[model samples]
Target: MPSSWLAALEDEASKVLPAVFFEYFRQGSGDSVASTDAAAAWDRYRLVPRVLNDVRDVDLTGSFLGTPASLPIGVAPTTLQRAADPAGEAAMARACAGSGVPMVLSSNASTPFAEVAATGVRWWLQAYLPEERLLAVPMLEAAVASGAGAIVLTVDTPVVAAKRDGDGPSALTQVPPEWLRVNLGDAADAPKARDLGVRDIAWLRELTGLPVVVKGVLHPEDALRAADAGAAAVWVSNHGGRQLARAASTAGCLPGVVEALGGAVEVYVDGGVRDPMSALSALALGADGIFLGRSPLFALSVGGEDGVRRLFSEYADGLTEALRLAGSADVGDVRGLEVREF
Candidate 1:
């Protein structure tokens, strides 16, 4: 409803990006829920608006594990950014750097981490760990050297999700022949992808000094385990509605993880978040931070860095409105929101 260039980027991306990328965000795991999860999670309450309390300037700046963010939100790890533009991660990094937003770089990305990092990327490396030490070891070390402020270790794919179709062998046939090989070596879960994901994170903590956050946690118990295992933060996510359909909403999962952390570690979330309403709803449900997935990819598909800026600004404005409407003036004030218990 709020007008901004972000809607324009989504419109342009609809025209340029491949059908699959658009479809990826169109459908989500939360659609299966019979009721509006937002209604159950939060009251449709307006922030008893104040007429003139002299609230002129709004600050969108914040930090994610000590890394600066132009806004409280930042880009989540989406597979390949280069699919959208030649600069890809480089453009994203520079743009986020310019905006003071932290850009989390994907290990599966098309652009090398070094290139993005060179542009002063506030990079948070995301990886899937392997059982083998040799493979995981080097990647963790490299992330530190790459100037990543933190490491987000993905643990959900203990094996990849079981999709209804084309997820198996059929997926290979889907790639166009013209698609160039920018992959590190091969597809994920190979000897390399797995190795770097698993134990290397441990080494990264012991060796590189970059704080590691465990991604893909959905249950409170797992969040507890991750914190015990040296995770500075735990992200409750289902892979941007792509990995699994009809899974629990990340918003639903956030409360438990936040409690499990007991304020010892940060609890962040990503999933089924398509707007600022959902954004504020998530924070209301007790998430220390929120991560946006498909939105950024679609933004990249349309206009690269400019598209990202537009989308992010839209989110910031949305949050501002949500805050104002909800009667909260800042991200911190969102804690007292009345949640509808089911």
Candidate 2:
């Protein structure tokens, strides 16, 4: 079951957004088994709370790639935000800035990097390297010039995955091309590089002079390789189950990736993180931080900037309550809490 607050927000979004647009944001590739199972996977772990420790004060403040964040949560990259609201990525950026959390802008974002950075949110730019790596040079250059804190290279999508039809008309077809990727300009149709390798990690880092975080890693060996390739962090994801139909959920894959890195680099996870328990579950399982994909869009659909702010507030409150109940005063202490897989 999804958290009541999140379910309510989603229900509200369904009423507010066009059926096609809503379906586009909600649907995953192929049979949808991975997308459907992503959230439920986190519920399989049982957290053993410690007692007798004082939890008078709980601090949610943390950092992502060494940049301070008010919370350990971030807004994961999603495409075509204009489909959600007129303010689009700018609205999301403002909310993230107000809440003092980080937001990762998508390569397909409707808003430009400079516009997002102007909001003063600690932001990272996500990219899908094209077949000719130079094709991404302009986008990357713009990101660095706009003061992006890091570069998040999405590794799962060599090519766009096939989505199951009949989820109303595709949002891609419904939204105008101009509203889809304002950042790419004329190169909007650039194809993603299918030959991504470990060397690409160093290439991005050296090129941008920003810490590179490799997203969409599930296998421990792959995570280790990314670390050896000098990734500042490895994000455990399956592209929110939009890439592979039966890929393992990030929740299921996080521990192995964490163990593989052995504190060599930061680890983050996304997909199906609906509530405080799910967020805490990821941390107790060894994730340095957690992110929300659909939930933030749902919030945007309902109340634009304020909706996102409220969503973050709810998570912060819920996390504080959970930490108090578990007798942990801070996020780092939550990592020491025991988690058992059933």
**Compared with the true structure, what per-residue lDDT tens digits does model 2 show for residues 1-342?**
335776688789999999888888888899999999998898899989999988888998877887768899999999878889999999999999999999999978988888899999888989888888887888899999999989999999988889865836677888887777678754578887899999999999989999999999999999999999999999999988898999998888998998988999999999989888899999898988888999999999999999999999999988999988878999887888899998
Stretch of 10 with least lDDT, candidate 1: 34-43
TM-score of each: 0.82, 0.97
Residue pairs with backbone atoms closer than 3 Å in model 2 (clashes): none
Residues 1-342, model 1: lDDT tens digits: 445554465577778866554544343333424122422343342333334443345555556886556677888987546657667778888877776777777776767668888888677888765555455556666667778888888876654543333233332234443232333333344543433333444665887687988888888887887788788888888675445555566666787788777878888887656677777777777777778777777777877888778777788888887676666666765766765544
lDDT per model vs. reference: 0.67, 0.89
Off by more than 4 A, model 2 = 1-3
lDDT of 1: 0.67
- Please report how far candidate 2 places residue 30 from its true position, in Å: 0.4
